[model samples]
Target chain A: MLERVDKAKKQIHNTVDALGRSVNIMEVCGTHTVAIFRSGIRSALPESVKLLSGPGCPVCVTDQGYIDTVMDLAAREDCLIATYGDMIRVPGKNGSLETMNRSNVHVVLSSDDAVQLACAHPDKTVVFVAVGFETTTPATAVAVMTAEKMDLSNFCILSAHKLVVPAMQALLSDTKNKIDAFLCPGHVSVIIGSDAYRPVVEQFSRPCVVAGFEPVQVMEGIAEICRQLADESPQVKSLYSAVVTAQGNTRAWELIEAYFEPYDGPWRGLGCIPNGTLRLKRQYKRFDALVRFGIEEIPKEEPNGCLCGQVLCGLINPPQCGLFDAVCTPDTPVGPCMVSSEGACSAWYKYGRRGKVHHD
Target chain B: MCLAVPARIVELMDDRGVADAMGNRWSVRTTLLPDVQVGDIVLIHAGFAIATVDEEEARKTWELFAEIAEFQERQAPSSKEEGTV
Candidate 1:
C-alpha cells in the first residue's frame, strides 16, 4: 500500500511539475479530506500544488438553525432522536444533544434502526435525524417507506440534507475562494454519476475528477487533474471507475424522487440555496418533523468566533479560526466542524495538525 | 453531498433487495433498476438501487483489493531477519 502510494505521489509530483503552474484543487468530499491527511499526502505534494477541502461534510455544512431545531426536538419528552453517531455532539445555540444527556436521543447506525425504534416505541414519536449527501438519504427514505408500509404513524424525519451541485456552484460563485478544479466525492458520484458534474465543468471550465477515498485514488485523481490542466482540457472523469458511472444510480434517484422533492435548503455557512435540499414529498409529509410538528424555521446564529463556514467552503483552514485547538478540540467542539468525525477541522485536529513533516 | 456505492444484491423482494456493502448488509429498494435480481451488483445511494453495475468492473475492483492485500503481505519484512537487518 505504501509502495503504491509512493508511486502515486511521484506521479502527482511529475504531473504538477509538468503543468508548471499553481493548481489549487478542491476536494468536495469529507472522506477524501480525511484520507488525504491520513496518508500524509499533503506533505508529499509540491508547494505549488495545493489541495483544498470543499463543503462536503454534511454535518459541517448543516446550518446552525437546523442544529438548534434538532436540539429543540431532542428536548421534547414524547420524542426520540435517532441519528448517525456523527451529529450527537454538534453544538447548537444553547447546548448539544449529547450535553442534555436525555435517554430518548439515541445514536443509530442506519435509518433502518430508526424504523425499528419507531416500531418498538409505538407511543413515542421516533424522529430519525437524516443528514448526508445522496449516500445517506436513501436509508432515511427506506425507513419512511417502511414506516408507511407497517403503518408506523409515529415515525418522522428531520431532514438536514443538502445537494452537491448547488454547493459546487456556490463555491464557484464565491469571490473569497478560488477553486481551480474539483476532486468530487466518490460515494456521491456513485449515486449522481460523473454526468451530474458535467454542468460545473462546462460552465466553469474547471476540471472535475470523481475520486475514491484511498490515498492512491486521490493521488491518481490529482495526477489526472494535473494532466487535464497541463493539456488545458477541463472535463469530468471518474477516477473510481469501478463504482461511478456516467448516469449514476438511477434506482436510488428514483426512490429519492418518490419520497422527497427539491426545496430551498439551508447550509451552515453558505446560507440558503434554491432547490439545493430534499424534503419529504407531500405524500410523505406526515413523516416529516418540520411539517408534522409545525416547527417553523428559526433564524439561528452561529458562535461568535467560529470560522466553520469558511472552513467548510475551503476558503480558510482550521487554524485560521480563533477558537481552534483552545476551545474547539473534539472533546469540547464549539462548531459542527469540530464535532463530526468526517469534518475537515476534526480530521486536521486528529491527523494533520502536528509537527511539520515535509516530504519531497 | 452524495455518497453512493455498488453492492451485489443477495436477496430480492417485490421492489427491494438486501445488498451487502463492505460486509454491511442493507435493505435497499430496486425502484430505479426495474429488472434487478439476486447476484447482481447494483449501485446504491440513500437506500435505493440506482443502477445495475457492470459486473466486470466490480470483479476488477475486487481483484485490485486482492492485489492490494497481496502487495501489503509482500512488503512486510520478515520478522526472522528484522533484528539482523
Candidate 2:
C-alpha cells in the first residue's frame, strides 16, 4: 500500500519535472475538494502541480434563482419545505431557508425522510428541495416512487439537479480556461458510468480520471492523469474501478430516467450550460414543486463584491473576494460557497488554504 | 453532499434493510441494488444502497489505514480465507 502511494507521488513528480511547466489539474467534485484538503495532499504534491477546484459543489453551483425559489416556497403557509442540511444556510435573493424564520422548513438527512415527513403531515404540501448531482439523484427517484406507491397527495420535488458532464464541458469550452486534465467525481461516475466522460475526453482533448475519496485513490487518479500528460495521450480512465464500472449502475440510471429529463438551465457561476439542470419529466410534472407553486427560475445576479462566481471558475481564491472573511463568514455566509460544508469557500475558510474546490 | 460509505447489511426486510456502516446502523433502501442480500457489503448513499462494494477493493482501503479495519474485518474475519473473500 505504501509502495503504491510512493509510486504515485514519484510518477506525479517525474511528469512535472519532465514537462518543466505548471500542470493545472482540476478536480470536478466537492467531495474531492474536501478530501484533498483534509488529507493534506496539496502540500504533499509538487509545487508546480496546481490543483484547481471546478464547479462541483451542488449547493455552490445551485443557481441563485433556485435558492430564491426555495426560499419563496419556505415562506408559504400551504407548503412545508424539506431539504438537505446544506441548503438551509445557502443565501438566496431575499433570505436563506435558515434565516427565513419559518416553522414549516425541515432539514432532512435522507430523501426518504422527506417522503416520511410528507406522509405524516397530510394537510400541508411537502416540497422537498432536491439539489445534487447523479450520485444523490437516485435517492430522490426512490422517494418519488415511494410517494406514488403510497398514493401521497401532498408531495413534490423542486429539482436543482445538474449534470457533471455538461458543467465540465462548459469549463473547457471557455477560451480563458487552462485546465490540463480532470479528476472526475467518483460517486457521480458510479451512477453516470465512466463511459459518460468519453465525450469530454475526446472532444476537449483532456484526460479524465475517475477517483475515489480516499487519499491514496485521489493521488492515484492524479498520477494517472500525470502519466497521460507525460505520454501526450489523454484518455478517460477510472482508478476506482472496483465500484465504478464502464456502464455504471444501469438500474440507478433507469430510475433517474424514469422521472427526470435534462434541460439547459442557468448554473450559479457558469451560465446556462447545455443540458445542465435535470427537471421532472413531462409525465412526472405533477410531482414538480415548481409547477405546483407556479415558480419560475429567473437567473439572479450575484451580490456586489462577491467573487464566488470567479472562485468557482478557479480564477481566484476565496480570500481574493472582498467579503470573504470580513463580511462572508460561514456563520453569516454571503454566498452558497461559504454556506455548504463541502463548498470551496467553506473548505478554504475552515482550512485557510489556497488553490482547491469541485463536483458531485 | 455526495458522501457515501461501504456498509454491511445486517438485515434485509422486504424492500428496505438495516445496514451497519462502521458501527452506525440505519435503514437503507435496496431498490437500486435489488440483488443485494443481508450479508452483502454495499455503498449506502442518501438512504439507498447504490452499489455492491467489492471486498477486495474495500480491503485495500483498510490496509492503508488500519483504523477502518472494523468495517473490513466484519465481512472477512479470518485471514486464511482472504483469497476466497
- How far off is each candidate at the interface, as Cα RMSD in Å? 11.3, 10.2
Best by TM-score: 2
Point out the worst 10-residue segment of candidate 2 chain A by lDDT. A351-360
Q: What lDDT, from 0 to 1, does candidate 1 have?
A: 0.79
lDDT values of the candidates? 0.79, 0.83
Error of 1 at B26 (Å): 7.3
> What TM-score do all the candidates reach, one by one?
0.85, 0.91
Relative to the unseen true structure, what is the C-alpha lDDT of residue A72 in candidate 1, on a scale of 0 to 100? 88
The candidate that achieves the highest DockQ relative to the unseen native structure: 2
Task: Give lDDT tens digits, candidate 2, residues A262-301.
Answer: 9998898898999998988998888999788787779988
lDDT of 1 by residue, B28-62 (tens): 77755778779898766556676666777565555
